[model samples]
Target: MRSCIWKSLTLTIGFSQNLWAQSIHLNEVSSLASGAGIASKPLLLMMGLVALSLLPFVGMMVTSFVKMAVVLSITRQAIGMQQAPPNTVITGLSILLTVYVMHPVGLDVYRKSERYMNYRSSEFFDKANVDMLLKAVQVSEEPIKHFLKTQASEKNLQMFYRIAQKIRKAEDRPSLSMNDYIILVPAFVITELTKAFQIGFMIFLPFMVIDMAVSNILMALGMQMLAPTMISLPFKLLLFVMVDGWHLISKGLVLGYPL
Candidate 1:
């Protein structure tokens, strides 16, 4: 009876050991699965971040922000305000102005989107969104067309129109695509550059005269070591401020485009 009891006890111990080993294997499998899930989460998060980063570019292209920002930057640089007023300040101001100018366009887009969404119509959504985009483009196109018409030749316009026609052939209403308007953007940009340079030249004229006069006077008085820039800069700033230069410049820029 003692020998039979010993054999039974040994068999029970063996079974218990097998069960423990099985539990350990299952635990390892669970740990591996959890680790894999954690690893995949980071990849998904990284992809989402990448997509979000592209949102600004998309917004800029879809809005009037691009031209507004570029023109503001050009104006700032032309005035020799290098790093003065800070890039952050300039960018913030430009963004604010852009939003102001684009308020109506944005409202139109929102209204169209909301109408489509309420009706639960995907087809209408596409058409409405495209129409909204075209409206915004129309606003931009007016200024561009005016600039191009002033600067470009008749032949250039004809060439641009031909190219537009070819490119927009797939559209149902090619004229509504504003294909010619799209072609005018680069030409308008060139015209803006020319006009800005002309303005910059005029701005430098008074400063240049002051510099030459101050240098000549100083040299004649044997104060050759004195710098003219120090004197001229203050006068330039004073002249600029006295005439409400910022107001005039801003007004001129706004009026330069057709509403």
Candidate 2:
């Protein structure tokens, strides 16, 4: 009687387990069907948040941010005061300057995307079309691509285009046209870096002259053990301030862009 009762209990438990598994499997299938029929709101919002988080990185890569940040950092180094303005201060200034230079481009992108933004706000997930997202991206990328193309030199474009042809498969190579973002972004980056270095070199010149002059005076006075930077730093700062360095730099950067 005990064995028979135990056997009956085991069968009941097995049946319950099978039923539970079937329900779970059916629920999963239904969820997939529902997901296919309508886009998920929470998922879209999460993706949008992620995209927003990456905006700074994207700005640094494609905009004048790289050039502004690099030049400003190099200028600080040239001044020989490692912690005076501070890295945070330098970065903040660079970001602000970049925004100033790219304001027109930003306005254009916003204008192009206003309709989509309004639609998303009004309907949220109800009107969310995957095509709308694609359209928004496609529309936004055009102004940025145009800005990059304007900044990137012909030689830089040719170099990347040639490299793309070599590495990509023949069938894919045809699609990788001269105007493709893959070719354009790297070229634009290199161009920005080149311009930054060119500006940095100019920034270095006056400070470097001051250093050499200080070093010579120290040598002549037989104080060779003293560092030139210790004397030249104050002079560099004075000169920079007298000339209103920030205003001049901001002006040049704004004017340099073809916008």
Candidate 3:
């Protein structure tokens, strides 16, 4: 009876000790996890703040903002209204139009990144890891890259690719893909600027005609003292308003994007 009691006591003590050890191990793990979570929040927050600061610049570089802004500015110049709409108004309008055109691309990126973004942590900061962030970027960039490609001309892409190859060492050239942003971004910018200039040129023609006609009339009247632009300004404004220039320009710009 004594031996059986001792054996049962020993087994019970061993079981209890094992349970205690496991509990300790679990508590340590939980504490460490919680600590890591706490640490990452501030880092993530800092990075997010930085990103927000740079967001406007990034949007301008990657989206249709370049084309929109350039076209709008040129239109303003064409109207000879340097300060009528104000720089702020032009920039704001471009931003609005850019957002309108790029909304679909943004949605596509969100959908593609949904899997990586959805996590049990309840906050993005808690769930964000290097691997997860990289994966999210990788998935999200596909839509953006596709949009860029659609806007970018093949000739520009090839030209940039050739330039990049020439700039890099032979060994490095193989690592540089045509789809790389270094190649795509400048190419995309060039393409957008080229198209914007073309639109600007067409816009300039009508205004140029007005200026020339006004100058001829002023010369014929022996009133060369009056600047043609000053005389033509009212006529230009009348013409623009009559044809609903703003409406047409906005419509064309917004619709021009492939979505």
lDDT by residue (224-249, candidate 2, tens digit) is: 89988998889999999999988888
Residue 2 displacement (Å), model 2: 68
Q: Residues 28-124, candidate 3: write the lDDT tens digits.
A: 3223334355456564455445545555556687789999999999999998988989999999999999989988987876676666544444433
Model 1 weakest 10-residue run by lDDT? 6-15
Q: What is the TM-score of each candidate against the true structure?
A: 0.51, 0.79, 0.79
Please report the TM-score between candidate 3 and the true structure.
Answer: 0.79
lDDT of 2 at 113: 54
What number of backbone clashes does candidate 3 have, counting pairs of residues 3 or more apart or in separate chains? 0
Off by over 4 Å in 2: 1-50, 120-129
Clashes of 1: 0
TM-score order of candidates, best first? 3, 2, 1
Q: Candidate 1: global Cα-lDDT?
A: 0.48
Q: Look at candidate 1 and give me any clashing residue pairs.
A: none
Better of 1 and 2 by lDDT: 2
**What's model 3's overall lDDT?**
0.72
> What residue runs in model 1 are displaced by over 4 Å at the alpha carbon?
1-81, 108-114, 117-184
Question: Which residue pairs overlap in candidate 2's backbone?
Answer: none
Which of the predicted structures, 1 or 3, would earn the higher lDDT when compared with the native? Answer: 3
- Report lDDT (CA) for all predictions: 0.48, 0.69, 0.72
